[model samples]
Target: FFFSAFHCRGIRDDIEEEDEQVSDAINVSGAAPPKLCTSFAHFGFDEQLMHQIRKSEYTQPTPIQCQGVPIALSGRDMIGIAKTGSGKTAAFIWPMLVHIMDQKELEPGEGPIAVIVCPTRELCQQIHAECKRFGKAYSLRSVAVYGGGSMWEQAKALQEGAEIVVCTPGRLIDHVKKKATSLQRVTYLVFDEADRMFDMGFEYQVRSIASHVRPDRQTLLFSATFRKKIERLARDILVDPIRVVQGDIGEANEDVTQVVEILLSGSDKWAWLTRRLVEFTSAGSVLIFVTKKANSDELAANLTQEGYSLGLLHGDMDQSERNKVISDFKKKNLPILVATDVAARGLDIPSIRTVVNYDVARDIDTHTHRIGRTGRAGEKGVAYTLLTHKDTTFAGDLVRNLEGANQAVSKELMDLAMQNPWFRKSRFKGGKGKRLNIGGGGLGYKERPGLGAESSVSYQTLFLENCIISSIFLKSERKTCMMLSHCRIVASAAVCLQPVALKVTANQPPELWGIACLH
Candidate 1:
């Protein structure tokens, strides 16, 4: 079906009947598991907690909360994978409160019972807010520690000893080193947005923090994306964990209508954006995403000079100023926000009606997160992307994702995807008397007449070099050999194939370089 945003002046209010039926099926895989809790009452939570759930107006549990909360309550490690804005925060927060409340009270000079570490400062605060929202039911204490805020104030909060501590990696390590907080007493540890944390180069800090926690403690990791590094990290820390996958990993939310428009160049983006800003912002709050921090400032300045008041958010701003900007945006004080990727990951605002990619995302995963900022909690939302030729590397992936969601793909977008080398089909056109056959093993070349063993070997080497250069986009190792003995391209058979060897060093694009030889 066509995305309605393209047909109207603003975000289309006419959502299709089929678009409303977003899939809620979840796949839970592991050893023996507890019965799935379809509703909050199934968990047999405390009466006050039940009242809080009702007061919050949560009618039913999200897919992740249905399966993941019970697993966490079973005292087993878990890796919760779901799309962003899928209520993943509440999935772990509810269980963590139960785990903390069942334990003894914190004593003087002691640490929190639960430690939740995420990648960004904004996410750290977001999780802390969630912790407070639910923890208030049990009169539980929670504190948020992150960078750019007052370190001494955070240290004071730590020294006072809260039952739950939400923080980012760097500041938490600093607190640990200063003896402001101790992880030895922590029995419940969480790595929210686990993939992003590791992606941002927090592996060493995360591993170090995990080492300080009690070995027998319960660990949990929650993220919208899962990667090889996260899998390896889970294996090292978790003890027989259950994997709760809410939906297909790396796929955009079905509730979001993605519209991609191909632009001639970067210079055309500003004009395209200016024409749509009035209609988009008039409908509801709009978030404009840029690739760099400097770009966020520049765009915000340009917009303000045009008499449009908007909020600006990036990592460079101090914590207080950033907090104020986000507060104003959340209260609907500002109708528009220009932000960098820092706001792309875990900062959730349900009122955001549309997200605009002024600068195309650097990678497929980033693109997924950028669109995820809208269409939260099954609310219909729209995302517009401005694409140029320089972003062709990820165009193929973007097109595939759109098609997977059953959204309409434009001809211009399909043409760009076809032009990408990684997705392009290879055609072999070579000299006569040489037959090329590709099989499960590798490429094979049959022999031709009037070619000696030595010359055949040289031709094979040249062919192998061509293969390496052609498939340089692949990251994995390829072991292949060619056995061709023909040349219509070269006039003289004597000098047709030369015995030249090439070796790609470690700095090359592909991680592994293959050494080819004659069979």
Candidate 2:
């Protein structure tokens, strides 16, 4: 029934998929899979634009581009899912540019013909800069609208005319409400990092701005992860959109190595992290994410005092200050940056060798993006972390993410997993017991009397960016969203580990779980 609404006239004979095994995640109903292009020329890009593509050093289409560009160029609405740093921006850019070029020439000081909305200021500028590269080849006007810059300049740029407007939702909403920008002529709408925009509490603003756009416009939604909100939104607006999932919906990127260390107390964190910083200082550029704005300060100071170069970034900093920090860090003048979650999702820098979680992230999505800051564009990178008692409460999600990243799981983590029925069930599903149920709804595991309520990890809470083992998300009227903080178990619980034939009895004691051994 769903497939009947989609038209199949967009398939081109020139493009050919490279005999790739399609992921089971992609669901196109009856439509044949969109043929992936072997090269950019297969899509019939203009010679001048192709010149710009090469001058920009793009040799060929990336995976997301290979799959997404063809469908997009076919003039069909699309929902593309790929991990961060996967060249997603270009995937959508090529098609949007082609479509714009096909139409009558846009005049300066005229309403934009296309709108590309994203979640952050950094990403907005990045997309706009990229658009200009291709748009300029055809003499198309492109501008970025975001907060923290001169509103007068942005308003003037919009008034003077631009065919492409890459903007953040909040500022764009302000512009639309103020009558400074017009979207009446917009025929192309893109929600880049759609999941992150919703995650950041921009749903209402996005929907409101989207309401102002013409319904006949072609829409494209791209995201790294898909939550229920994203799925629901897609259903409401996208008309039989072609779903192009480049990778598993929530699968972790394989380019980064995840490392975890057990920290017994707050006293140990500074000393432990400082030693790592000293050793890693010369290795490459680094980004350290702390949970609180205040935490960024203390970590930055300690690192500087320890003779390591570092910069700080947080929500409280002024725009100019933040820009300077990011600029210095990217310039390699500041090799290390201590930041809060504000910098987690968007800000892409070059050659960031490692991402340090000085403070444990609030959720699995946060964790996924934090690690994504490094290991971009297929470069090898590392995500180092200090796991404390407060954080071990999420041992299930943490362990699965580590294992998914192909890191060596320590015995301590394995023991923590042993105590978690959710972890045992998911982490060893194929090898161990079938799904177990206790009472009416719980897992068949005895809860330690000291741990309070009995619970199991909500399998439904697992996101496609499959780093998280399990989670339970709750909606809030005021806060937008919050994940359940209640944990299944704690350290005092008894555990026994049987790593293959290397089995250890419960009599060996839980404290011994921390001892090092060959995995």
Provide the overall lDDT of each model, using Cα atoms, as 2-decimal numbers: 0.72, 0.66
Supply the TM-score for candidate 1. Answer: 0.77
**What TM-score does candidate 2 get on C-alpha atoms?**
0.76
**Which residue pairs does candidate 2 place in steric collision?**
109-160, 109-161, 250-464, 250-465, 250-466
lDDT of 2 by residue, 1-519 (tens): 432312322221111123232222232321323344446655556677889999988876677776677567655567887767778888888778866765555555457878999987777877888998888788888989988878888888888888899999999878777778788778789998887898789999888877787665678988876666887777666655666654445545678888877778878988887767766767889899999977888878877777887889988887789888888998999989999988887678866998888888887667878888888877888888777765645666666556544467789776765676766765476532111210012112122223224221111111122121112111121111111111121111101111011112213443332322222
lDDT tens readout by residue for model 1, 266-289 = 889989988899999887899999
Candidate 1 residue spans exceeding 4 A from truth: 1-24, 426-519
lDDT of 1: 0.72
Tell me the spans in candidate 2 whose CA falls farther than 4 Å from its real position.
1-17, 21-33, 107-109, 406-408, 421-519
